[model samples]
Target: MNPKARSYDYTKKTDVVHSEILLPKNLSEQLDESDIELDFQRIADLVEIGETTKRGKMKSSARLAREWVLCGVPELTRAENIELFEQFAQQQSEEQGVLSMVFVHDPTAGDDMATTKAAAEGKSMAAPDPRNIHAHILLLTRKLDVSSDSLLSLGEKSDSELSNDERTRPVVPKKLVGTIDPETGKKIQQGRGLCSNSEWLKNTRKQWADILNERLEQKGIQPVTHKSYKDLGLTFKPTKHLGKNASIAERMGVQTEIGKYNESVNRYNHNQLEQTANSGITSSQQQIARSQRWIDAISTGDAYIQRQIEQETQQEKHVNSRIGQGVRRRAERQRPNPYEQQLKTSADNRKQRATELRERTIIFDRASERADRNARYRKPRINGVIGEVDRLTMKTALLFSSRRNESSSYTDRQKDILEQFANENSLVTGDFREDIRVTTTFFSDADNAQTHKHIVKLINDPEREEQNHSKTSKFEAESDLNKSTRDYVDNESKTSNTADLSVSIAPRRYRRP
Candidate 1:
């Protein structure tokens, strides 16, 4: 619980099912405190000495009320908890005339956070253990005076704070106790606070356990302990209580120092319990052996017991194997593998670095084939060939966003890939620069303009059926797409052409073993 929360937060909390202002037994009978009229806000103002500024507001460095969420028996209902709080408050707190406000926090399976933001926003950031049933008790250090006939006056700081020597002496005895100032001739205690001694705190815990046990026993439930394993003479370490932050971390499956410690403690306690159980069984067997006659123990009975033990061992082994496999499977799937994460990160980095390096030098290499065709028959315009050579000599990264249209060296999605890379690194896509394509050439003979024109005429002309069909068949056989490309040497006579086509295809490479 955050101590800085305002008094109104108690009533507004989603976890808080019911809240009421509680009075001491004597005051409850003597005074007529209206439940409808009284609230946490009014009670807080009455307890603290507020300021006398414009409208006499509470002064100084922010008024903060400390909050303690007293966890009750989970089995207890909201009403039972409120009742438990009343009994505990009256008996343990020594609140003779103290007015206290107790809020019963009853949460659902989906609950919950109690801070003002969570309550106001109506959402839970950290899903609490639904089994955790608790209460919030707010009591003022100042006492309610019953001496006044008409009005109940909020008196000086209660003896509860004064009783603790640690709070009085070192912290400021004169101000806290309202001791008369020698020079000012005034007794003032604007900052009234409460702090319990270690003995009192221990006693309060013991009392809580006692009262909780009483409640549990009434419902026929097993009573739990407030004492440590050491105090109870058990061979196990006690777990430390995880506070808000640690609990949130633990719930999120994050390993905190306290959470790890708790896990080890729980494991040790479980093992100790198992050992105790085994010892009990052994002790029972010894008793049986001692009680039995010598002949009864020796032959048939011993053999029967041995057979029973062997069967049980086999059955236990089978069950344990199944459980072990299931546990291992779940751990593998559900547990975060650090090595797997590291490898994934490494692979991503490697791939990205490789991509960047390729795009950086793509101005040079083409290993895997593009266009799915041999480059032997491509032809380029005289101007385009000269322009490409000149552009290469400049040795600069060309802007890649507009370069994908160059069908020769760059794929259509080359731009998208580079843009994605740039976006990932928060670099501008337009600034992702690389020059691969020669600007005017196409990658394939299918991109040839004359081939497209000839195919269109073959399909459209109805009169040239015989020529079209004959040529279409021949074209389909001898690379239909690249048949009779713009590069010219007579088909029968292998002679060089007089002039070049506008688009260039790479010259055929000789394959060698």
Candidate 2:
């Protein structure tokens, strides 16, 4: 009820077919049957009368009585709807420690007179409309205060004294429980007041819908929801509710302004939904085409590489066989001549040189063959690693773009990773740093052989022990002054608000005092 209203006479309307008051179980016996009976005038008088405070001020309008319209669907009978509402009222009374008054109304009850007349004349009567079966639930915001078994009063507390647990005791709207008042520098606490929260209405709607649906399902009827189209993620627009005047006009075949507006909104919503669905389909098709092209390119590249590797292997084998035969013929020619002692020393030296060269050539050939075998086995794995890196890079880019308002620290980390990869491969360009094939080729150059070996060791190490050792050495080389400066800067940033200022002071020459 509005506190400023002149009267609360709406409860006395003729549409109220039945009315009853509900009380908490503990206080049920305290009131007489006549006192507990639903009388709107007496209830209003009780609500308006409040205790005087310590400051000698009458606390009029200290309590609120909220009215809820509990609707019934066509699937429910009038008796079932009344029973459901009664159960809900009792539950509220027990759990929330409040008083409830339920009034059931049937707008179609007037049609019963026509039905009775038709029955007397032996004529059939039309089915009554089921839309007007609803209940009005009046809930008291104040709990009953029981001092003794015989003494009962209305409970009221100052806003400041209300604890976290007691905040929800009153049938008031929820607010920021401990928000401080800027004007008074005091926390705004809970109190007995009118509900101002729109969220409360939404919650009540959902609760009533849930209750109705549960009862419907128990009776093997189709369940319904009370959510709006937008809440349910539906594209359709909902029609506005027509009041009694507009409803009467609409029934008389008149097109109301609201009806025309609703039709326009519905048409616009349908066109927007169609456009969105078409755009989504187009985007999905484009993505599919791009993925197919990538797959074809990868397959073609792998086939070409396989042919190249086979051709190189055959040429290497031919070159190695020729080098082996040439070394053997040189050794045979350099064999010692027992009859010529002078030439024997020279021949022995040549044979020793040939043997050394043959050993070196054989070792190089074995190393090259091992490298070829490793490359062949690792090619697919390398491609997989490259693909994974590409995916990660794209994901990072998208994330960064979406969160452009975020701090630059995240972008700095991405840059650090790219720089490290580039340094490992001895590459000047940071672009394509995530591509494994590009890095491998850059590291395979003759000038970068040592760097390539280090990178290969780093990859095989898995735990990066070598990198940690290098970091330790670098940390040891850092000067104490640099560390102190960094610490000072961090501390100043955290502890002080004022900026550092540079001051120049001349050296003072001290005289005998």
Please report the candidate that would top TM-score against the real structure: 1
**Which lDDT values do the candidates have, in the order given?**
0.52, 0.57
Please write out the lDDT profile of model 1 over residues 1-513, one tens digit for every residue.
223334433333466676767767666665664322456666655555332234445445432232456887665676787788777766633543566667766666223553334557764455666667777776666666655445555665555545564344334555445777688787644332445566556666788788888988788654656776676555777789999788866665678999888888877765565444334322332332343333343324445545655665575567556655765665567658856755665575567556645653452233212211222222233234333333321211222233333421233343455446435534343322212222112211223323333322222221353465679888787784465663332553443232333124547679997
Candidate 2 per-residue lDDT, tens place, 1-513, comes to 234446434533455567788777766765663244436666665555544455545466454566777776655777788888887788667756777899898866544444455578886655445576888888777676645444445675423224444444444345755777689797666655434345445766777778888887787554567777677454677778777566545544568998788878866764554444333322332333454455555555546555655665665567556656765676567656534643554576568557756765675566556656655665666565444434332323222222222322224434454457555545443333224334444433435434444433333231343457668778876866688889999998866543322222445679999
TM-score of model 2 (CA atoms) = 0.38
Best by lDDT: 2
Error of 2 at 366 (Å): 43
Q: What is the C-alpha RMSD of each candidate to the true structure, in Å?
A: 35.1, 32.8
Clashing pairs in 2: none
Q: Indicate the residue-level lDDT of 25 in model 2.
A: 78
